[model samples]
Target: MPPATLSRTEQSYLLDGLRSKPAERADRRDLHEYRMMQVDTDLSLQADGSARVVLGSTEVHCGVKAEIESYDAPHVNVSTDLEFAPWLPPSPRVQVMVEYSPALLHEHNATELAMITDTVQDMLQACYALTGNSIGPLDARQFIVVPYARYWVLHLDVYVMSWSGGNVLDAVFAAAFCAMYQARIPGTKILALDKAAARQDDEVDQDDPAGIKFITRGRKPSSSAALDDAVDFALENEWDHGRLLAGREDVPVCISIYPFEDTYLLDPTLEEETALSSSIAVLASARGHIYGIRQRGSGELTLDAIHKAADVGASYAKQLAQTLQARFV
Candidate 1:
């Protein structure tokens, strides 16, 4: 049988709604309201950290694993892989591998794949910057037991279970943030390295749970009090099943804005996404600073539209950040 296609009437209706104001959309959400979101963290025992995020009908799962590796620098390594369900349509399946040296560099095949990789890379960099380049509260030195020798390396993997359209970047960023929030690196104590002996001897302690110090950012009591209350409510209702993540105060959330004629809509649906003339994504810190911005889709964006979209995205980012913070708390 031939593949099914949208009927002309259906297509026309969707296009008309996309061009209309947000209130006219079938969901009746305001121009600034986002679709419903559900987030769960620490769902995988085998991984150092893991999270599953569902935004409207789109679902994504992210897992983070870490290990100690000999390195010359003190930077976190990030790798991202995006996989669609086997039943989904045929599109590019790509993986982005990045190693942070003196500069950031990535390896991928195909121009299209390269673009995807660059987009994801930019998002990850923004996330790291939003956290002040610290894993939790500890500085880069803390991540290294032996400077210029051995340090921690983190691997992040993300899988898309469903694509209902809209901005997948928002979902990806949320999942990555949740996974990183829940990630824990095992603690270690380094012994002195002996080089004068006939045989060099280096010893390190690696198997003591009591010595295991969790990577965490110190929480600010002023803002954390509200988060704590929210957490209590979530726990009571069983909405959050994972342990509270450390250093959550610095995490950020992203929001994507789709532009119709003169209106910028927040969290467009699949139909709206298809009809969008242009789009922009913004990554905002928990404190409301714009950390990163990217233009998306094939449409051109005016300078005014960019400014407007950033402002709108900031609002949504704040809301989403608070919501995710409460979940992680």
Candidate 2:
């Protein structure tokens, strides 16, 4: 069967509503308003952690799974970007001075993997509030390099089975936070390493790394967190750089927004998403600093709107941070 296509008028109607402001109504309702309820959830026996996020009627389930592998190569530095880039010739001196940026794969699966990797990294940073402003490449110290053999590595997998729009990023972020809070990374003590040895002759014992010290207790994989109150604590202390993250707080709060047409929405639904042509995502810190901004679609944006959107997002985000911190910290 042939696929159905929208007539020009139908497309224009959607475009207009999404891009232009609607006729002013007697009652002034802002462009974006959303309400979400956490409905049902379950544990992932096969995954490190997982959860189901329900935004009103829409539902999305996210799972986190991880494995440790021997570090290979210098430690692959993963970078994230919103749009696809077309290659261009480098300047004469630029090529000589800087490392060539590698070309991204043209395959669908590869592209998807790239996106997944980026999302997982973001999820980790958001959940843990890790230090160092570095992006793209993993730091050398984070990986133990083995030239010809395996090195220790951590891999995180996230699955999005269902989605309804209110902010998949928010849902995914919340889910990932839950999952990581419940995740188990077996604590390890460094074993002695002989200076002059290869894997074949290495004396480092794999069976037990130094000694397995019981620092963080292990828990049976359950559907929910044992420390539910921690979420409240996180909300209280907040994710301020020195204040909350330095062993003082629990969860850091963030606000993100999607821009459509000319009107901006605070939180968008699936119907609104389907009607829009493009979106720009902005994330702000509690201190009113712009952490990240990304334009996800082909939609155009004006500097004025961009400035206004950041202000809007930051305003909402600060409130969220304070609320969460009040509950937790």
| Strongest candidate by lDDT | 1
Full-model lDDT for every candidate: 0.56, 0.39
What's the count of clashing pairs in each model shown? 0, 21
Worst 10 residues of 1 by lDDT: 84-93
- Candidate 2, poorest ten consecutive residues by summed lDDT: 91-100
| TM-scores for all predictions | 0.65, 0.49
Q: Write model 2 residue lDDT over 1-329, tens digit each, in one string.
A: 00124466865665555544452211233566546436233367765445565655444455544333432112112233111111111111000000101221322244554564465355345433323421111221222222112222333344444343335555554444344334433323233322222222333234322111210222222322122221110111212111111121223233446665445665555545544555655555455555566565566778887787777877776665454334332
In candidate 1, what are the lDDT values of residues 30-125, reduced to their tens digit? 776777778888789788778988888767778877655553322232232211111111211112233212111232224534465466665665
Error (Å) of candidate 2 at residue 23 is 8.7
